[model samples]
Target: MARTRLLFACLALATPLVPATATAAPLPASGLVLSVRQEMGTFSTTQLSCEPAGGLHKNAKEACAGLAPVEGDFTKMSPGDAMCTMELNPTKATLRGKWRGKKVDFQEVFSNPCVMHVNTGKVFEF
Candidate 1:
């Protein structure tokens, strides 16, 4: 009886507790994996989170905030309205993460860092 009680207690402890006032729709998971290859030929990988404000990103909070609006879609983050210079600078980016329990895989190439920064905001600033 004691062993059974202990097992039950352990199982209870392991269970995640949902808030009583949770939103009607489930929110996305708060994690991201980003890879960026800059125009200067340097590469960097960043991890980010929205809730905890933690990650490898130079501006973790701002990066996560920037990511939240686009719902983890790199294609959506691209700003077509940006008026960038004619320079041939290029940057490659990849992003993989979970949002609303769905898998996201995105890859993109920016014509220049100016375009990248204008469009992507703080997401790839690191």
Candidate 2:
């Protein structure tokens, strides 16, 4: 009975030392934010930060890698021939964020999702 009482006292004292609310560390500096809009008007968003890429993008790693070479310049990216149908479908993509510490804002329209995927690499494959 004495040991149980002592144990209860210890737990009671320690409980007060613990915080009722816990806090999480702040999010790291986000380097990039990308938005993709398909021809049908549906859209998706993603983010890439400092080094590790994240968010809802299908190929965050590949997208980030593709962005690095162009430093976020949409025009500089090569639009490879994606062997898509001759349809004139269009898709638009936009990005606003920092790249290697420099502010970046980019927007471009591709012939179609297939063309965009092949030309833009994974940057628009969300």
- TM-score winner among the candidates? 2
lDDT of 1 at 39: 75
**lDDT per residue as tens, model 2, 8-123:** 55334322232447565434343566667778766666555535665556687888788777877755888776488867778887777666667778888877778777778877
lDDT of candidates 1 onward, in order: 0.68, 0.66
Candidate 1 ranges with C-alpha deviation above 4 Å: 1-28, 78-83
Q: After TM-score superposition, what is the CA distance of residue 86 in candidate 2 from its true location, in Å?
A: 1.4
Model 2 clash pairs are 80-119
Clashes of each: 1, 1
Deviating ranges (above 4 Å) for candidate 2: 1-30
Judged by lDDT against the true structure, how good is candidate 2?
0.66
Give the clash count for model 1. 1
Question: For residues 1-126, could you state the per-residue lDDT of candidate 1 as single tens digits?
Answer: 964564455334322356889755533366666777777777666666556556567898887767777877766865646588888778888776665456777888988778877888888777
Candidate 1: worst-modelled 10 consecutive residues by lDDT = 7-16
RMSD of 1: 11.7
